[model samples]
Target: MITDPQGTVLALFLIFCRIGGCVMAMPGFSSARIPMQIRLFMAAALSLAILPVLWDTVYPTVHTSSATYIGFIFSELLIGLMYGMLARLYTLGLQFAASIIGMMIGYSQPGAADIFEDAPESSLSGFITFAGMMILFMMDFHHIVFRALVDSYTAMPFGGVMQMRATLISFTDTLSSTTYIMLRLCSPFLIYGLMFNVAIGFINKLAPQMPVYFISAPYLLLGGLFLFYFSVAALVSQFGQSFASVFIGR
Candidate 1:
């Protein structure tokens, strides 16, 4: 049964290279909190699991010369990285929206440690980001990502030349879609902040002697928090719903 143990091992490694590359860049899995050893083992396990299903495609590729094998390794890694980055970029758009929402709503306090990443973020931003990611997990976004990864073998195959132009286009398209979605999510806050500020500006002009900035700060925060409490469910729900279209539709 194990006649070509060397070939099998090579094929497994090739599969590992692709899956490992994906895990390396994937959002939740690639977090700084996750240990490298865990990531490695996870990738290896996935590679072994997928090898049986993809054996026909992968096994033949491994029988090639060393130079060609090296090329395949790079190609596989690039392909997987591209796929992982697609999901990662979409989640990153949520973070961008969080920052925008915080700024628009006057929640500009000093930044605190991010719940998922090592970076610092405002409390409001952190809340939004955390909530969005939680919703994604609840909706089992990883299942979609893994399904895409499995389908990629057929789309990309084992040893095709890496297409740099196509990869760049994919990245740009993901960014474009992500930006539009994030803007849509945060647009309410943008409008609210604008209207509130404009009204304040008129009031300030009328009562120049009053310390309007200091007086309006509390009202701004209160109204913003109240609006957030009422609308957060819809905001995050839309975020979760749009993930499929943004990541898969591309």
Candidate 2:
């Protein structure tokens, strides 16, 4: 049993490369708030847990020339990254929508955050983004992704050529679908902002001396916040449902 210890270790590492790559880009796990060491440990543990289930299929594939083995490792990492990006990109849509929501609702000022990010966001935007992420986690989105990852080997075997056309189609479809969802979620605010701004513009035109811009700011903020309070639950629930269909559905 111990005769091929090196081979067994190599196989396990190959498995790790895939799972590790996924964890590297997955939400929450990949967030700046989470420590790097913890993510690595989680990936390693999951790989070992998965190794037994995939042993028969994985073990034999690794006994190859060193060059081919390296290629397999790269492919495995690539596949994992592809899956991770599929989930990550969809989740990121919520953040993208948040910025639009904040601007539409007259909350365009940026806020402070403990974690680092490239894009600046308003307080409302940050809150919505954080809330959406929490809801996704509570809905077990990660569980769905990981389960799909396990089943991927069946659909896409190791040491096999990657399906470029199919992969590109899926990636493109996900991008388009995510954008549609983001816009749909923010459409109400867009309409509200447009109508409110138009009405304010007319008032200013009617009374040239009136400070309509300053006068309407408070009302805009209040109405937007009120709308958010009433509709946030529905928005998050819809997001969860749509996300499940995207990754978990056939």
Candidate 3:
């Protein structure tokens, strides 16, 4: 049986390894603006908080060799990073869809205008990024994310087997699903872009001299924006469901 102090410290170290790795890549904690010291403290605090609950299962013989210890830490860090990146990738689908839709609508033009920030938006890409972030916060998706983080300990135990091949397959499938989701989410705008452009082509053939392309721009923008606004609620609902399914692995 392990002594209380040794087991406690070991568990804390392992948990913190995971937490630190995760915070380094996870979206909310991994923002470029957050100070490294703050992130380190937060990870340490989380590890400390969870140590008692995990102490029963986390005991492992300490490696005397420096190389072995480094290997263990690296493996644990890799596992944590994998989970964090998965979560971040899943959430990014919304932003990707928004960008695609905006681009199709011609709102993705570079330096056309600025919305939430001073940086110019190409076609409403900036707006999409901003809106996606807002929706994430407003929906309280972070709570689910925290829950997923806690559950990751159970799913992937400290010093667990790597299962690299399976992980690669799972990661690939997740990425594929993300791409499909983005395409499907933005399909309305794609269709609108196609039809609007086709109509413009016919008008150009008929008028020969008129600036049909310029005239078509307003209609495309209006149609795309109308579609986006009308579908925003449904799109968010779909995204929330998809997000939950992706992270919680339903």
Candidate 4:
């Protein structure tokens, strides 16, 4: 049963290259808080689990010359990176939207430690980002990503030449879509901030001696927080619902 052990090891390594590349860039799995050793083990375990399903496709490709094998290694890594970055970029868009929301709503206080990543973010932004990520996890977004990886072998068979143009196009499309979605999620706050500022400006001009800026700060923060509390559930719900369309549609 252990015949061609060398070939099996080679094939497994080939699989590991791609999966490891993905884990290196995937959002939750790639967080700075996660130990490198744990990431390596996860990648290796996934590779072993997937090898049987992809044996026919991967095993044949492992017998090539050393130079070709090296090329395959790079190619597979890039392909996996592309896939992982797709999701990473989308989540990053949520972070960007969170920052915007925090700034708009007068919640631009000092940055706090992010619950998921090591990066510092505003308290409001950190909470929003954590909530969005939690929703994704609850919905099993990782399973969707893994399913996409399995489907990728058919779309991009092993040893195929990497398509640079298509990869760039995919990244571009993901960014564009993410921007639109994030903007939509935060549009209400944008409008609220703009109108509130305009009203405060008028009041300030009318009562220049009263220090309207000081008076309005509390109101701005209060209204923003209230708006956010009422709308946050819907905002995060839409974000979670849109993941499949954005990630899988492309």
lDDT of each: 0.90, 0.85, 0.72, 0.91
Candidate 2 structure, TM-score to reference:
0.94
Q: List model 1 lDDT by residue over 1-250, tens digit each.
A: 9899999999999999889999988888888888899999999999989889999989987888999999988888888888889999998999899888888888989989988789998888888887888889999998898888889887776698877887798899999999999999999999999999999999999999999999998999899989989999999999999999988876
Candidates in descending lDDT order: 4, 1, 2, 3
Q: How accurate is candidate 3 locally (lDDT)?
A: 0.72
What is candidate 3's lDDT per residue for 102-169, written digit by digit as tens?
77887746565544334454656655655665676677776776666677667766565767886787
**After superposing candidate 1, which stretches have Cα over 4 Å from the reference?**
none
Highest lDDT among the candidates is held by which one?
A: 4
Clash pairs of candidate 1? none
Q: Which of 2 and 4 is the better model by TM-score?
A: 4
Tens-digit lDDT track of model 4 for 1-250:
9689999999999889889988899888999888999999999999999999999999987878999999999999998898999999999999999988888888869888887787788888888888998999999998898889888888888899988988899899999999999999999999999999999889888888888877888899999999999999999999999999999976
Question: Cα lDDT for residue 248, model 2?
Answer: 58
Give the CA lDDT, 0 to 100, for residue 141 in model 2: 92
Off by over 4 Å in 2: 1-3, 114-119
lDDT of 1 at 232: 94
Clashing pairs in 4: none
- Using all chains and alpha carbons, the TM-scores for the candidates as numbered come to 0.97, 0.94, 0.84, 0.97
